[model samples]
Target chain A: MKRIKSKTAIVAIVFSLAGPLSAGESLPIRNCTWCHGSSAQGFSTAPRLAGQREKYIENQLLSFSAHIRDNPLSQQYMWGATANLSPEAMRDFAAYFSSLPPKAANDGDPQLAAQGRAIYELGIAEANVAACLVCHGPNAEGIREIPRLGGLSHAYLKRRLEQWGQGFHAAAEPMPQITRALSPNEIDALASYLSFVAYESLE
Target chain B: MKVIGLRLALPAAVLALVLSAPSRADEMGGPGFSSQELRAKLDYCKTCHGLSGQGYRGYFPMPRLAGQQPKYLENQLRAFYERRRSNPVMANVAHALSPSMVAALAAHFKDLNTNPIGGAPKEPVALGKTIYELGLPEANIPACSACHGPEAKGQGEIPRLAGQLFPYTVKTLGNWSKERGQGPAKDDTSFIMAATTHNLTQAQVAAIAAYVGSLR
Candidate 1:
């Protein structure tokens, strides 16, 4: 694990580089922090990069680098700009970022989140959706290639669902078919569930 | 806005055409993914991924790997094992499967019929459709179909959000945006999400998540 001081030093090293951005190594913090945050804690809009699985991070980096995972809003400047970077750098950066810890989510509407939690645990019958626990796990923890949803951003959640509704499926596995059936109200309940509910476990 | 929806599927259609590959070495046109283990996993995965592995709909997001290429499946499985793909939660699950098992799972998924995952009859579905057609425009949010495709299927860079499981979508989105040291989904995608999330609200998100999950 990287100590805060060490991470600072690494950033310092990157800052100290007098030449152009290195392709063989990770992208300088400058390019990364715009969305990830200066400390890589991520902001209200994004999830934490620290304390994440390294290989997962690497794959996503590769997706962006390869243009396999593109965001209409973000890709224009972030991923598209970094596509030229070497694979080694992508891995190194993924390793470095994955090693960091996540920033905790701030206080939200616990009751509303709890209301959302009910839907997460058990799906609405009229909607015909499965319980969130069926695939995500009982505690909102995710399954293989599936991510957990606790302590995330209200704003971010909103956009993603819109993306899903409108049909943005950057995720590799099953998401392509998943968003097809969602309705706006359901998106709201789920988002509330995530924003307000505290996940049972982080691991 | 209507024009945008009309154009939504162009990318996904093109993607399907591009990914349509010739048969690989020694293998027939089916189950062309990584390994046989994946085929076995396919049976196990059907509970959530659907019989065809296309997934039930927005709430499932399990992915429809039925005819995906071996290289892509192999790389994805390996990436999950090595933690080079998607998010930590998936990486953990992917890692649990043995190499051959992952390959077999991929193979199984690749062999399934993706048609089941195809477009549902054009009707009013719910959350996904509402959001897709009309974003929180006041929030300055963009409709997802603009890039993702009208049917919620995806193109190159974009994935198909339809039929994705509720948990996968919720969790992955959280992982990408919920700050550092939070949970398993951390990584660079977090950055991409930051800018995108700027246009949304929590309640809206919850509704959409459920809507997407409801796809049968």
Candidate 2:
């Protein structure tokens, strides 16, 4: 009788636990990490999704999926994974990745930081480009449609600007025209400035 | 007095109607969208363009793809890829992608739902209303709806104007004033945008930008 009761109780507990298991329960990782890196921070020239806004990340991936946004330079590499992301998977993926804290920006050169700051706060007097701060918010947290540029990795920022110049529309927004006006020097300066600038507020 | 009128009008409501309409004739659809749809999985082009391979409106000059057929979207996608299309920026986007990916993308957006995102904003949207109704006579800019339609829903080649990434919208207009190829559309009709912005002072640009941002 004791053995029978113990076996029944074990079966009951196991079945109860099993029922609660959900397909969505996975972290959306554990696979694809070899190239994407364990932290989802990206490897080589691929992007770092760690701590990114899930909506934004998903939006980018969707662009890849839908082809609204593409990078010929990087196309062959990403399509393999981006293809499998269904709309549902995209949302779950975005939500999963966006929920985590982002990695900190790399420590940068102080001298370059000051130069980049001046350029960021005040555009080249000759180019007529407005200060990024005027539109992006004083703290670079971004507002509405513009993106937060500060504290992002320099590599990411540089690549994004290069893509923008190359006509890679984020598609989620309309900046290709604006990006068309960005000179390589301006892009470099902006990327450098944006990388080291700290976000002064979260709100 | 004009400021007072802006304070009274419901621009956000009007903007929603303008943004959620169908895409243009030679194109696809409007800025049809919803935050809920986007948040779901990010895989839906229908979240804005419409299901059944239709396109919708967003920004200026971008048209609807719904019912237009994926073949056309594929062609445009090809144009974007090769630069046969005049859009240098869109070309870069197309170029970065593979033909297969482009086909899939065109298929999705062409098949996504056509709806506005979470209703439109509840903001007063006053400034946008002014710009929509009245021309910047000082700058010789015409009423927005003349080509764009009421509240900027758009018609023919004109595009839906609400619910866009406001920064991109503002930047495109501003860039059109500065760059040659980066106008409102794939075609040269973007001359309209260059003309409208021709006389705009920085303050006018900022005002219109704020108003437009308040929309969708």
Candidate 3:
């Protein structure tokens, strides 16, 4: 896996140098694909960009550029990456990434999935947690500006949920409030359930 | 020994009275929820319905409850619980709420006043205003103002349309029959809308939605 990652990084670097001449697109795909993985399926800390809602991706890019999405990792990497990008370039990137087919991360604890599904669908009314499906969709295939939550990596999902609770991304409305209602255990369950969800199951 | 027994009896009677007071208050139509519970539930509701009950646009548009008629809100909550309304999300939400909680929530939303989260097109507003004030006689449409009031502030079981989300109103009006009055028993209030919702053309629906959505 380490060897393959290094090879991917080398190829990404090569492509970054030769990309503009061959593709005619000024925005370098390597800039995102470097950490997001060759297929944009997400590596380690970086989230999967593939099959994300176009508007959501665009909005996030704008947020990152404005430094509104101030999570540690975002500030460390995405802030500089999006700083120089124009609106058209952001839209193009969003369109390109959103068109790619997504694959489920499938790297979460299977035992917790049922509990997560319950939280996702019905919510814990006693705890005052709102049903995620109300806005995220039944299958978690988000619409318009809502980010698709299905098939994301457990680590990425968990970190993001935790960050919202920690008050990192204050600009994302309702998320901080929503995550505040979630306990550490609930977050684990949610992240686990979402990781194994395949987008094709919607059919 | 007699004095000690009498003192014990007095204390026991006071304890019983204190314990019974909450149930008695519930029987008298007071809110079953504590202030904290009510606040938490309201926050849960605002998570999708907008922080100020101005409504929100999500995967499905959550309707504005701000300044809505308490009677209408209560009836809708009942409809959801009874399966008269076909919304699965609302059904689950309504199922969790007791009658007193429903009443309390409705009353809370009834007092909220917020501006519309405007996104409707400006072009068809004139046509919308015309239809709102004076219905198309040829189409058998009565003026919305006739029932919803000139200011669009509804009374009793009639819902207030002022400051409602444009997309939400459009979707609700468009799929009224499909979403509402789904139970074995008939819903009288929803029945009145059956004809009105059916008669309006797509363009007319957009116009009316745009107009009411812009109302303060």
DockQ of each: 0.02, 0.02, 0.26
Model 2, range B1-216, lDDT digits (tens) per residue? Answer: 433343223234323433464342113221332332222211223232322223323322234443234554566556455544455434544554445544444444433444332222334346556766787777688877676666554443455554433444556567753544333345555556777776766555655555544443
Please say which candidate is ahead in lDDT: 2 or 3. 3
Candidate of highest DockQ:
3
Off by over 4 Å in 3: A1-25, B1-30
Residues A76-159, candidate 1: write the lDDT tens digits: 655764667777877777667665545445344544666566667655432334356666666554543455455556666657
Best by TM-score: 3
lDDT of each: 0.54, 0.51, 0.84
Candidate 2: stretches off by over 4 Å: A1-27, A107-109, A143-146, A170-173, A198-203, B1-216
lDDT tens readout by residue for model 3, A42-139: 99899999889999999999999998888899999999999999999999999878866689999989999999999999888778788898899989
Q: Compared with the true structure, what per-residue lDDT tens digits does model 1 show for residues B57-156?
A: 4324555555444555665555555554544444545645555555545554555445544333233347546876577677776786776567655554
For lDDT, the strongest prediction is 3
Interface RMSD of 2: 16.6
